[model samples]
Structure formats: C-alpha cells, structure tokens
Target: MIISCYNEEHTILQVIDEVSAVLPQAHIAVFDNNSTDSSKSLVLGRIQMLANSANIDGGGGTYQSFIESSAPESKNKVPKTQDFAAKINVESKRAESKRLDSASLDSPANDTTLFNATSITPTSINPASIIPTSINSVSTIMPNGGRLSLFSTTTQGKGAVIADAFALLDADIYVMIDGDTQYDTAFLPQALAHFCQNQLDMLNIARATINDSVHRKGHSFGNKLLSTAAAIFFGKNFGDMLSGYRIFSRAFVKSFPAQSKGFEIETELSVFALQQNLRVDEIEAPYKSRPEGSFSKLHTFRDGFRILFMIFQLLFTERPLLVFGFLSVLSFAVSLIIGVDIFMEFLETSRVARFPTLFVCVGLGVIGVVLGVAGMLAHLVVKGSKEARRMAYLNHKKIL
Candidate 1:
C-alpha cells in the first residue's frame, strides 16, 4: 500500500494503523510530500513502535493486535471541527510537542517499552496510559509485513510522489490511499479480492456515500458531471473519477503514462485505462469526513477545471476526428449563416457592399476545412500510437 500525505500529522498514524489492521500481509510505504509539522516524526515513531513489537513477537500476526489496543484514545476520537484560530492554536501545541529532544526519543529504542516515558500519541498523548502490561505491550514499531520504508521528498505534487513510489517499489499489485483517513480501510480486503480473483488490471474504490457538508456535496456533483462527460467521450463509465482509493496491477502501473501533477491525476488514471482498454472495475466504499484539524489539499474550482480540461485534452488526443470534426462543422455552419446574409444583401443592391463580411465568411470556411483535415491527420497518428501501446501491453506479463 502506498500512502501520499501532506501536513496530515493529525490523522496519518490512525490511517496507517487501520491499514495495518485490515491488510496484515500488505507492505505499506508512505510518501511524505514535504510536510513541515510532526507528520514525518509521528509516522516514523509509529513505524518504529510496530517494528519493535514484531521483533519481540517473532511474527507479525500476534503483534498487530497489541499495537491497536495500546493506541491512544485521541486516535479514535472524532474531534469537533475547529475554526482557523483554533487550528492555529492546535498547530502551536503540536509544534511545541514535536520539539522534544531526539536523544530521549532514541533512548527508548534500546528499552523494551518505547512509549513508557514518552507521549507518542498523535493529538494528545496520555502519559499515564503508557505503562507496560508486560514489556511486550509497549514495544516500539517499525513496520513488519514485507518491508516498511518512509520516503520523504521536497516535491509538492501527488502525481510526482506516486510516480516516484512506483519507480522505487516492485510489486505485483499496488494500492493507493489518501493519507487523510476518508474511506474506511475495512473495505480494502473486498477491493483487493476482486482484482485477485477476476484477473483485473485496475480497481477503483467508488464512494457510495459521502458524509460531509456542502463542499463535499458540490465535489460529488462535480465528480458525477466529469464522469458523465468521460463516459460520453471514452465509452466507459467510471463510477467516480475523483476517488483517491485505487488498486493497480503491475502491468497497469508499469504501462501507465502519468502526466498530471495534481488532483487531475485521478482523472488521467481513469482515462489512461479506458484508452488502453485494460480490464477495470470499481467497488463501492463509504466516505467519511476528514479528521478535525486535517484539511484537503485540493482547490475545488481549480482542480475541477483542471479535470475538465484533462478530459477535453484526452478527447482531442484519443478521438481527434470526432472532437475537431464537430468543431469544424460548427465553424462551417457559422460561415454559411454569414455567407447567406451577404448573398441576399448583394442580390438586392446589385453590388457587393460588405467586402469585410465576405472576407470573414471566406476565412471561416477555410478554417473549417483546415480543422477538419487536421483532425483526420491527428486521428491517424493517435491510431498508430494506440496500436504500439497495445502491442507493448500484450508483450508484458500479466500479474494474475
């Protein structure tokens, strides 16, 4: 599993814990996209804590439950929404807490119980509850499934982070989830089950229910609008175009050409699958609100327009004949309208009075023909590229 995160210190650990719980056998890697807060430290500490437990237990199966049980109460609580002032106050507290001496943090690594003297909880650590029920209970974690690695980059885009992660890890299957906990991890097993059983190339987790305020509602509507447009253009209806939860097979991942550097990556992913004619499917998952103090990185209007622009771009690139042919037809119709008026005026007056209008009509007609011819040429180029991609994909080994 690959997690892409920003300044999500408030909710990152809980999200990882949940992923670890639901998919015990899955290897998890987190890509921290230049976070300034305690996000990196908290994630690293939790990972260290888990690693310590696994080493002591000899196997991960028995150690995971202990980590879950000992998690702080704040990790489970749904905090009340706070205003900017309250958010700033909370951040200040977080900064102060993160300033703890690194010497002390590393000191517990040698001890049996890492959290015994430290406040490692995300929101507010309760020092009293850190006592060991045995040395085994308070052990630190590093992550023990396949291998755990936390990669940090100074980059600022989700697509770049994911691209880097893909290049770094070699796996049969890849699952991506937003660092902020929005979709429940409990549904992950079912999502993966389909891909494995059906030999599918891509599986997108569609949000069956979005539980948030007006902004979320608007986002849902925008997603539907974009999905509808995509369905029309691509001939495949992706249930949700903006959902961050997705699973991809090795072929799909390796063959994919990722270009978007922002939220539009989701749209690009779906379009790439459609263009490649890959086996793709979707599973319904419940969407929950972001944890309090954790916010979204997407600019709705900006990203929404970007998504729409991507769709149009794919349309022209994939089906240039259809898109530009329509534009050409529309231009031709406008020129015909202007030409008819000019003809009537000249017939009545027995002279050509509107020379500029005649020139404008002629220009429109020429542009219409030029666009139509260009679209045809582009269509041929796109077809050739599609054939090349399809042949390459066929030569690649299938994950299933």
Candidate 2:
C-alpha cells in the first residue's frame, strides 16, 4: 500500500505512474488539498474519511486486511551532489543483488532479484514513466471548494492519511513517496523487498542523488542548513532530513502515532523511530527537481526556523535537562563576550565604561548558571523515571 499527498499536478502524475510500474500489487492512494491546477485530472480522485455504512462496516473494512487501521486524523527530499554518482552506481549493483522478493533478503551476501524487473525506469524518465495500478482512498473535489465525496481517505497530512489508508486496505507493506516525484520510484522493489526480508518496521529512501539546480534559492538553502543542523542536533547520519521516499511494515503503521499536520510530519516519524531505537533502515536513492510548472513551497528563514524550533521543542519536551543545560552554555557565552568587552574598555580608558553591559551580562550569566544546575537535577529525576519505564517495557516484552 502507498499513500501520497499531492499539491502539484505534474509531479503527482509522475509519482503515481512510477509506483504502479514497480509494485504492481501495492495499493495506491492520494489526498489532494484543493489544488488550483489540473492536478486533479492527473490523479484518479481524492481520498476521504471512512463513512459509517452497512457495506463498509459489515465487510469489515475491506482495506483492513492490507493496511494498518482506522483513524481519527490530523495532517501530516532529495538527493546528493553530482560527485556522489559513483557511490550510486556501486549501490545500484548492491541493490540489485540485495533485492528481497520474500522472507529472505537479510543484510548482505544473500538476496534475490528477478531478471524480468530489469526494465524498471527511474522517476526522471518522463511524465509517462509508470502507470496507476489500483486506487483505495478515493475522493472527488469540485472546483468550487467543496469535496464531493467519491471515497473517504479520512486523512489530514500525507503520512497520517496514508497510514490510515493502508490500514483500511489491510496492506502488509506500506510505501510513502513525495508527490513532487523527486524520490526515484525504481527503488520501490528494493525497499519493499528489504522490508519483507528483514521484517523491518520502516525503510526510508534518503535522497542520495540529484542534479543540483539553483532555481529555488530559499528552499535549497533551507534544506541544506536543516540537514546540517539535524545531523548535529539529532545525531542522525542522513544527508537529506526531508527525503520523502519511505517504506514500512504493518506493525509499525499499526502502532504509528502520526500527529503532525504539515511537512514536519516526516520529522516526527523519523525522530520517533530514532528516539525509540526502532527497527528503521535507510537506503540512498536518486533525487531530482520537480517539473517547471510546480512551485517550490519552502521558505528558508521561516520554514527553516520553524523546523529548527520544532527540534528544540521536541528536545526540550523529551530531554528537558539537555535543553536547559544547552541554554546555560549560551547564557555563559553572552556573559563572557560582555566580560571581554568590559575588560577591553577598561584597558583603553583605565575605567569601567559600560555599566549597562556589565550588569546585563552578569545578570544573564547568574540566571543561566542557576537554571543550568536546576536542569541537571531535573534531568536526573527524568532519567530515573525513563529507566524505570524502559525496564517495565522490556520486562513486559519478556526481553528482560
């Protein structure tokens, strides 16, 4: 099962086509958010919420066997520099060999690949790349702004909506891709097989390749900066923090707590796995710029700031001591910078020249120091509680 949120026409069409070709048995779904373009025609229809009906309820959610579950929802990329081309070539070989068609495809040295799939095309091929197979979460939106219900997707964001869609369909394996078509569809089989073989909870296709362009300065720079910050803040080794290509198993989707409303949905999903130490996997894949008609929706300063703030928000919420302690360091840096300025002033004029600067610096420094110490104590308490919970979880799982 595959779920997608599409805001553009050309990209959405290409994305639908590509996945259908690679994973023929996989279910495809899309949630359109009142797009102004012909993006509707490109997609078969819109996805909606499950209705309280006799057939839908009695048939036991026909999708339930394939997807994760029904849900009350809210809402919820690419590639490397050119020099990484050689690495892609190498990975391509490994991937072909690493293709897992069933319950096998372990780590390395043992995987399966059928020769007939050799004609699989990359997303950059053209608009006519792949074709649509089957549709599950179907919807229809009249141009006048009201949704004329054809089928219920019952989704808000891309991730949450699709998660529910897959659950409704009862799909064992679920895939996610950007509506923009930047994430290569050729890797679908590889990711799918990887999930099946390892029985992994999730597999994300990190944008590991791209043909760089300077058309969208704000989005490009924001993405790069965020990627760098995420590496440091979350200790993730991913090159692209916002890569859209991902795959997951029934277990992960069933238990997935998808609570994000926008692009941040990806961050929420990735971090949840990393933070919880779940069975998550990463694969490098080709990336590309969207077609000309589609507009880039990234805001470097605004969105980047929002994402950065979200990281801190999650960090502080999850690890308060770390957040407070880090703030204390900044507070100390301010004091030191001000202290140096004061000394320099004294050296030049042989007297204290900046009483305001000294006062402000010293005040902040003392407050920061106080908060830092308090945060340390708080962290110890939090840590102990977390340890207890972890032990309980482990014991319950019979792992302890």
TM-score of each: 0.74, 0.57
TM-score of 1: 0.74
Q: Which tens-of-lDDT digit does each residue in 265-354 have in candidate 1?
A: 888889888988889998898888777899888877888898999899888888899998999999999999999988998889988888
Best by lDDT: 1
lDDT of 2 at 305: 72
Quantify all predictions' global Cα lDDT against the true fold: 0.68, 0.51
**Which runs of model 1 end up more than 4 angstroms from their true locations?**
49-144, 210-215, 343-351
Model 2 ranges off by over 4 Å: 41-171, 214-218, 254-256, 328-400
Cα displacement (Å) at residue 47, model 1: 3.9
Scored against the true structure, residue 396 in model 1 reaches a CA lDDT of 59
